[model samples]
Target: MPVVLQAGSFGRIRLIYVLVQYVDETPKFGHTAVDSSSGTPILNSSAAGVSPPTPAFTPSHYSHIYGSTPETLTTIDAPKNYGHAPWPRISPREACLLRYFIEELSRWFDLTDPHNNFATSIPQRARSNPILLDAILAASARHFSTLPSDQKAHIMSHYGLSPLPSHIHDSNSELSITEETVIHYHSRCIAELRVLANEPHAVMDEDLLAAVVVLRFFEELDNPFTSPPTETALHGLHVFLRAQASSALLVPGPRQASFWIGFRQEFNLAFSQQRNTNLPLEITDSYLIFTGAEDHVWTNRLVVLGARVLEFSYGSSPSNDLEFNELVRLRDEWVDKRPRSFAPIYTESPDMDTAFPKIWYTDDSHITAAQTLLLINILLLAYSPSIPRIGPSRRQTLESIDAQIRTIVLEICGMALSNRQSRPAGLTACIAINLCADRFTDPQEQRALMGLVVGTTRDSNYWPTKEAERRLRGIWGWDGDDD
Candidate 1:
């Protein structure tokens, strides 16, 4: 008889491993006898009156024990080759299972997808799979390399790629270059083309090339790898060529005229604002400097340019011959008003012949004293019409006045120096005398005239005389006469 083991008889049986078997005979439950004390199997279930120990009713016994015979197991439960289980082969089903596992694991691990794919559409499991990622990249490179050169080039251009010659020669090498590297190389090419476009001798076709390069550059501007080109760089290139042509014109060369024409054309285009304003003097000055035209002649030209600017902006005319003459006249009038003589001291009311003469002043008291002021005044006069007009040919009249006053001052100084009797006169006296002196004159009479200007005094009126003497002393660097 076969014995049956009850479910609760064995304390919860844990399944360590499972082996399935198939039966050739009617599946009779069997048991084997074991040494009771030692718990050793001493007898087989096939022995007389000893049937296989009744199989347990547990799920593990049904799955492992009943299918124990190798041949029977092969028929009932297909045997798996534990030594050579196929791996690294992920079917679509397996992929889905893997992705699901990842999603569940990510939740448990608190990992997140930066692309938010997990929150939106499920990512293709192959995309997230490491083994699939390498396969995809390799396959992409192979497909791209298989394309015809022209087609490849077109595609690359669209994507702003510039594959190196070596990359083209070797498909493996192309794999090394990434989208970012391609963009960087293309940007460098565009920058180089922009520089070439500004070269005066750059081929006409180069413009087309530069345009293409710029187009590529613009396309890639949105790429994180490509920095946007600056407007200043473009404008600077255009301006640089114009300046180069202008510089060539300043040199003695056969291309001078042609260069200048080109320069002006380019300049007008590049600086339309200045051209529209008729090229103001400041702009002209800047142009000259940019063209490296630094010379004294250029300096003078700039001054003339400034004058022209003043005329243009302020509605003043450039100085003419008549205006120049007027400047001279103004300068002379300023010189002629200087005093040449000081009053003399008298002991008594002098006799008529010897009485102190009246002091006369010239129009100008000193030489070169009013020169700078005169120049500034001339500049003002030339520029400012509000200043009173002096004469008939307003110009000639001002000039004549200037000359007359200047002559008077020169004459006074001459006489004062000629008549000097004691000490040399102070600056005011010298200036005054020089203004009054004769143009042809002697130094002695000039000095004598200066001393007379010092004046005579009477002792009886000592206080007033002293006061006057003190004043004169201040002028002449002297102490007043003592009692």
Candidate 2:
């Protein structure tokens, strides 16, 4: 007769006893293993098969999460006469770089939000698709290419590779190496995705899109190009995303990835030629088809608005006082009517007595909320409205605008300060705060702002934070040169 396993009255694990005969002729002696979750098998005392000379199924780690596993998302047999390489083939050194990337890069990748973590999802997708795997490996290499000398040295040791000298440092050698790998993987992704692109309907080619997004990030984090294609990256990214958008437009499936790309393209605009903001038509279409989730929808709307401000302020779009008023009004309305789930962060108890060091990490609502506030701040601070020759100089308008910005900055600083060094939104908030650092208006507020930026640098040591320090210093004329 066989016995069944059961949970105890108080939900404690029941003792699982198995009869066993050992080589030492001991009866009922066996190795014990804990069952922490459902369906996992137990360990037996004997090295081979315990009690019986037969073996049963072992515990499996590859449980399906997406209803069913598709053949496309798995390892495949190499063809005898394939036109292209059947799988991604990397040298031993490149494999070492891949290992370094998998461990360190994933941490910062999801520093802000754990929802839909790209760190995990990208690698998992790679498991099923060799092209995606190559792309991720390439991405990780790109990240590796940017690390400081000591960090890269640690990576070399961690991944069992030869440590290079700090003098041969990350001037451009590593970047060049990674760029070759990226171009290689990108070429492969393009080939694979090009085949899928013409399928008349939207293909669920998330891995490819993800690779593009990652590559875009690599470009954004890039140091001043020893190479060209800063402009080319923007153009290629826009064109590929536009193609994806066209597919989504023709066939209505889950277009969340397209929406994601639109947001990315808008963010990428910060570094692009502002006058060239005539984006693809598909970005708008994707947003239109987006189901209205209050927080995300409005935030993306703000992204479009900020892009418009940039477009109009520059020579790209024709602008007037009415257009400027409309953009300001839209931002104001969004600020006023944000949803409860993502309401703007504020100082509670008048002194921020109740807030944590980084409330956004504790409160899910504040993450996107801070982002919206920051985008609005950036739009107002960075771009002029292009109002042609107004009477009274719009002095009152400027003062009012300054006041609105002042309040938002202090509030964000309060949240960031409360959240301290470990806050998720600190980098995001600090970036915007640095852009608007000139409007802080008071000496103490400026000091607090300085402290926040410095503390963030000490704690997180992100490249953007270092840039923010430079920007903040420039705002106060602490640096002799104007940025």
Candidate 3:
């Protein structure tokens, strides 16, 4: 006879077992039941023709058979082109972006307020702000990984992130690294410095330090792989140093000198090492002074320096052999006409007519040749390696010229700052006047010349005292003012 298990309970015999043990093996057996109380089989129906007792279906049967409920199955179907490239690595651009974001955020915490440095600002805050920093790092790495190796390297170099040390490993577990990774690391350094700078309770001196750090980083950006820095980097460093030295920190003594010397040395090295022959003269001068030891080179350097000093003091170009002479002649002529006041350095000769032609009479007639010479002299004075010679008489003259130049530059700066009416031509004229002051030697004479350039009467908006004071402070030097 066949047997059946009770409903909602696991039985010794299931459908397959029942078929195997009874129907398949013993065809003569009909319906049968297995009693739960006793492990014994009981006939319920006869033979194959009779029906067996119905059994109830319950959760326990399925539970024992299949275990627990099956969880919702999930699988990611990546696109067909998904494996084209390996997972992206961190990049320099992303690093820079991350740094920028963090520094900007830190600004909100009043980092500049000397009383609140980073520690005091958030005493309980965790070290490194890992959460934010990691997010930035991950995002940057992903974005940069999409770019080509060379492009990534270039950007990394720009951010000072390339040529990373062996310790900064990537996923391949390989020690070999790409330039882009180094650049990203550099950006991280910058961002870290920026955070420090932004910390409240930062000392006044820290501001200067921050400026120096930024300048140094920029200098590094010019060339990443090479030890020698580029001209662009040198120029940028000089500009920053000049500005910083002139700021409230007053970096004038040995510190300033040391910075300049280092700058000059690096600049020279770059010039000498450069493969390009068509490098600029200024860059060449920068290199030669450091690498070459010839007396003649020193002489040339002195001359250049002297010329620059004179230009800054007098607002006149002494290097222009022709214009220098013409300027002297013009000054003499003007002195002769108005002996009471100093002669104008520049004047129009009604007798001569050419494109922007004006005879600049100097102590000598040869100084009035070409405008190009004048322009060149001006450029040299503005960006020269030489220093000026000072004597009581010359110093007095320089002071006068500097004052006049300051007055003019301040006016132009003010105009630009105001964002007022269109004053493009006026600003250009002001810059030209400043260049003239940079080249000239006699302060009184330069002022007079500047007056002539500005057409005698001063503008109503021109407040000389306040403007001069502001500019002097901006330049971080009191020497410009005659007072």
Q: What overall lDDT, based on C-alpha atoms, would model 2 receive against the true structure? A: 0.48
Residue lDDT tens for model 2, 1-483: 122212111112111111221111111224433211112232322322323323332222123555555454456432233233321233454456555555665544443333434545556555455445555655666666555667767767766667557666332333233444554444443343433434433223555555556555555454321123354234444544555655544542223443344454445345233343545533563442324554545555555565655655664444466777776776677666666656435435334332223343345334544655565555555455542247786776677677777667666666666555334345555655655667765655666677766666455443345555665676676755322
Question: Candidate 3, residues 20-89: lDDT per residue as tens digits?
Answer: 1212222112335332212234332233233334355344434555685223211322223222321122
Error (Å) of candidate 2 at residue 339 is 3.4
User: Mind sharing the TM-score for model 1?
Assistant: 0.14
Per lDDT, the best of the predicted structures is 2
In model 1, where do residues sit more than 4 Å from their true spots? Answer: 1-278, 285-293, 296-300, 303-387, 390-397, 400-483
lDDT against the true structure, each candidate: 0.30, 0.48, 0.32
| lDDT, candidate 2, at 241 | 57
- Candidate 1 C-alpha lDDT tens digits along 220-242: 22221112222322232233333
TM-score of each prediction: 0.14, 0.56, 0.21
How well does candidate 1 score on lDDT at residue 69?
A: 42
Residue 329 accuracy (lDDT) in model 2: 75
Candidate 1: worst-modelled 10 consecutive residues by lDDT: 9-18
Tell me how far the alpha carbon of residue 181 in candidate 1 is from the true structure, in angstroms, after superposition: 64
> For candidate 2, what's the RMSD?
19.2
